[model samples]
Target chain A: MKHWLRIEAVCASLAIRSRMAYRLDFSLSFIGMFLAHLALPIYIVLLYGVSAGFGEWSIGDMLLLTGTIQLARGATSMIMSGLIWHTNERVQQGTFDLLLLAPVNALGHLLNRSIDFEDSGLFLSGMLVFIIAVVISGITWWQALLLALLASFAIMFFASLYILFAAITVRYISTLRLFEFQDIAAQYAQFPLHIYPSLLATLFITLIPLAVVGYIPVGVVTGHLPMIMLGSLIFPVLFLGFSVWYWHNTLTHYTSAGG
Target chain B: MDIITITDLSKTFKVPKRKEGLKSAIQSVFRRQYETKHAVKNVTFRVRSGEIVGLLGPNGAGKSTIIKALTGILSPTSGEIRVLGFEPFSQRKDYVRHIGALFGQKSQLWWDIPPADSFTLSQHLYEIPKQEFERRKNDLVEKLGIQDIIHKPARNLSLGERMKCEFVMALLHRPKLVFLDEPTIGLDVFAKQAIREFITYTNKEYGTTYILTTHDMDDIEHLAHRVIVISGGEKVFDDSFAALRKIAGVTKHVRVVTQKKVVLPKKGVRGVMHISPYEAQFVLDREILGIRDLVKAIAQKTEIIDLTITDPPVETIIAQLYQAKA
Candidate 1:
């Protein structure tokens, strides 16, 4: 395990150096992610101006939800940026074979290879919004802790889902549309689950579960739907376990590049 | 002891078949068709420790498939394979630790970074001791004359330079077995000689075993002691290089330049390929006429000035082998 950590560190440093080599590209992507996150709040504010708020939540509560989702997305992007894009690149280019040749944990190395240090700015901006929401919500300290903890797991939840698609991409090279699925999930999860019909809300929290990642955590922080928060904790673990099992089974489907 | 052992190993691929026209295209979407390609069939061979064996074959003749199976890139469809006391595909992690592989068409180096960074990354990946890593790194850098280019990014380096660094990376861990798939492909003569020399030096000095696959016969002639020829997904020949020459019934061309014109024997020798006033070249099968007897016969007739004997090039023998197999 110590050796694995060292290897991860090495991979992270290499990733940083690789990005540092292209300063302009790194800066542009960093600012682009920061602006993208900020743009979401602007859209939320504009929606609140037209309509009082989303369902029972006020504009301030909706801001908290948006900020929480942004934080989850930022953390996921910063830590696992390479998950989708690089996996596709490696599988198509047949370089994943080289990764498997390494004696260390191959998945760890792959995750390390995908780490994007450029998303640091987005994480910081999202954190600012999240803190402001926490201050305004006037929730107890424990509620804030629970929200933070669930939000962290929510990142893992996103990872599990994205990793499943990564596994799919490895087997069937044409399944890059999974990214679009994630995009749609993220778009819907930005608002409260009640904005949709009851069945769709249940599906978002149960089947898809992106709603639990962002919206439910904010709901718990605001002292609304405390019961859903407890269930959110269990769902991501089961989903991640299922994702890992699927990943291992799909490994056998890897036919490599050439016949 | 054999480092690699295989018995009746085979690998088959299911390739998707495409149909022409809009109607067939729509049908393909509903029920795709696949054609089974038997890439490797009933092939078996073994490599003893400290041996260099060359895998020779024409294109699409399953040479790469066998290498892929041995390297754990592709799992065998059937049969058995043991490399370094482990089944290659099932025990890939343990097996790969004891072996190194280099593909000519694919590079393992981080293209945007200098090879030095890659070497450091590999040292950590392979878990080599710091002192040993430094020692090996310095030695290879010096020997391969990559000191000037080691710090340059791999993308900026020449193919020869990049390949030298690749050799360094592969050998850094001192693996017992190494696979060189077309190691000298698309290299200049000097670069090829350097690579061949490095392989020989490492093999002799460290007792490393190598399995090389290439269409370049010169690579086999220069580096390999034993040759395995495959055709149509089967092992057609597996033995020492000399044994292959003997099995092909290949003859050596003996050119003799004499001080005076000499009468050439029409019998006993296969035939004279070319003749001039003072020089003659004859193709002689050593099994039919011994070299000593032929030289003595020529010397007896005229004073010999210069005589040179050369075996038929490996390309000719390979062509004949493939033709015979077909």
Candidate 2:
């Protein structure tokens, strides 16, 4: 594990240096991500003023939900979002083979190869909102510990989704349409889970597991976690394991683009 | 010792088959036809340590596929390949530590950063000790004469300079075996010579085995002790480089412009093109009609205006081998 972290450090340092080469574009990417993630949390705050309860949730509860969604996606984006774009690009350019030549798993190598330092802006924005929401909704220290554990699971869940998308990208060689799928998942995740019908909510809670990313963690923070839905916590770990298996299986479908 | 071995290796790909005319194309959108292309057939060969072997073939003749398999990027459809006693595709992570590959068209350097940064990544990637990494890196930099170029962004460097940095990155870990796919492609003569010399030096000093695929016959002649020719996805010829020359059958293409009618060297000369009675092109068998004998025969018969003798082109030799295979 120490050796692997050293390798990851090397890849991350090089990636940051490469991004910094074009200073203006680097700054613009940071600003773009910062503004893009700021809207939903700000919108939630504003909506709570005109309406006391927006769809059966208090202002503090909604803030925690939006904040949890932002933080989960924001952190995952900083580390693994590059997997989508670069995997598509490398597969198209035939450089994906270079990943296999390394003395590490190809997926792990790609994750490090495409670290997105610019997405740190989004992560910081999410951090700001999450702290504010946590302050608004007070909780005991044990609850805080549980929140931390669940939040780690949330980030893991989002990262696994990126890997799944990357696995699909190896076969398709294009990620343009994949953004739509991710957007829909995120859009569903930011709202309270009860807003959707019970069947669709159950699907989100387990199968697709978008609820694992935001609703469950934020629900704990807001003291609204569904006792019956405690079983959903196991889905993130299962999803991560499946994503890794699926990635290696998908590699066989990689008829590399060039000779 | 046999450092590498492959037996009955094959790779097949399923591609969408196309038909002529717009109607067929439209129909194909709904229900497409597919065809299986055998990129590699039951090809087999072995390479011993410290030997340079050249894989010669025309474009799309599966040379790159074989390299990909040997590098552990692609699994063969059928067969077994063991390099240093590990299966390339199954034990790739460990097997890859013992090998390195440089595909000339694909770069290992980051385009936006100095190659020096990428080298640090390489050091950690292969888990080379820092002190050992620095020593190996400095030595390669000095030898390749890229001391200054390593600090420049790869995009700013010239092709040869960038390639030099690439070479340094590839050999930093001192892999036991290396695969080079057209390493000298699109290089100038000086750059080509430098790369060839570098390969020779590395092979000698480290006892590194090399499997090279290139179109430049000069590279084969200069470096490869053994040559393997692939055509139609099969190994058509494998032998010493001198033997491949024999496959050209000791023939040289000679075009002559004369002051008089051409006098045939009846024993070893075959007429090829008769443009005019005074001037003609012919194939001269160097073994049967020695250069000295042909010159003497010609001088005694006619006053020569101009004479040129060149070896048969590489295409003819490949065609001859393909025909022999058929």
Candidate 3:
């Protein structure tokens, strides 16, 4: 375990150095992401105002939902989502051989080296809105703590799904473009799930599960969801378990087929 | 002790068949058809503790597949493989630390990061002691002449420079066994020589066992003591370097210089390559005709000035083997 931590630190440091090399580009992208996240709540407020709110979900609820999604996306991207984007290229070029040969767990090493510091701006912006939404919604400090815990769990849960995406890419090299589906799922979190059609909502809660990542946390904070729903917490554990198992099973079939 | 052992090993891949046009691409996805490819078929071989074995084969002959299986990148479909007392696929995390591999076509170095940074990452992954890592890093950098390029990002480095760093990184762990796949594929003569020297140094100084696969026969000729030839996913030949030439029926060129003008012996000679009053050269298949007999016959005609025997080039011998199989 100590060795794994050391390896993770090395991977993170390498990623930081590489990003530091493009300071100007990193700064520009950070500003763009910050502006994009900052403007998101305004758009939600305008939409909710014109629509006179969404199914008892006021503008404050929308803000909380959007902020939490950004928080979850930023956290996931900072650590593991980049591997989803890189999996296809690495498998195609056969460069993933290095990861397989590393002394560390292949999945952990891949996730570790992929840390993206550019997401920090978005994460900070989301945190600021999250705090404001908590105050305006008059949630207790304990509930805020619960929201934070659920958000962290959601990050792991989403990261596991992306791992499954990456594994699929490894198994079928042609399916690399399917990685965009991850972003599309996260995009679903910006709005209230009940506003969508019932079928879509069912899919979101079960098969797709994007709403479960952030929406449920907001629901719990606003008294719209029972505290017993914390049992839903076990779902991420199961998802992560399945994801890890599927990844290893698919890896055994990695043909290293391409030239 | 044997560093590697394999028996009846095979690997098969289910390659999804592709059809032309947009409609077929969509339709095939729903009703997928696969073709089973036997990449390695019931092949088997072993290597002792400190031996360098060259894996020779034509394209698609499964040389790379075997290397991948041994290096724990791909699991075998059937049969058993034990390397360094571990099943490479099942015990990958523990087994890989004892081995190193370099694919000439694919680099391990992070393209956007300096080679030094990659080296540091490797140091952490391998968990080498700080003092030991620094010592080996400095020694290999100087020996491979990569000190100047080690700090530059891998993308900016030339192919040869990147390859050198690749070697440095693979060796940094000081693995007991190493697999080198086409390690000198696109290198200049000087770069190729440097790599050959590194292999020699590592093998001698560290007793590192090696499994080298290359289409470059020069690499096999320079680095490997034994050669294993696989053709069509089967072991066609496995023997020492000198024995490979003989197995391929490659002839030896014999030139004899006489003190005075003499008549050349015509019997038992496959081809009289060159002829002069005092000197003659013949290409002789030693299997059919013995070198000692020919020299005795030549000396009986006139006092021999000098005698030289040269084996055919390894490239020609391998080409002949491939052609015969084709």
Residue-wise lDDT of candidate 2 within B131-156, one digit each (tens)? 99999999999999889889888989
User: Looking at candidate 3, what is the lDDT of residue B56?
Assistant: 87
Candidate 2's fnat? 0.78
TM-score of chain B of each: 0.79, 0.82, 0.78
**Each candidate's DockQ:** 0.44, 0.66, 0.56
CAPRI verdict on model 2?
medium
Stretches of candidate 3 off by over 4 Å are: A48-51, A197-203, B18-27, B249-319, B322-326
**Model 3 B-chain TM:** 0.78
Candidate 2's iRMSD? 0.9
Q: Over the stretch A138-197, how does candidate 3's per-residue lDDT look in tens digits?
A: 778787888887898788777887889889988877575666776677787677777899
Q: Report the number of the highest-TM-score candidate.
A: 2
- Which model is ahead, 2 or 3, in terms of lDDT? 2
C-alpha lDDT (0 to 100) for residue B266 of candidate 1: 56
Q: Arrange candidates by TM-score, descending.
A: 2, 1, 3
RMSD of 3: 6.6
Q: Give the DockQ (C-alpha) for candidate 1.
A: 0.44
TM-score result, candidate 2: 0.89
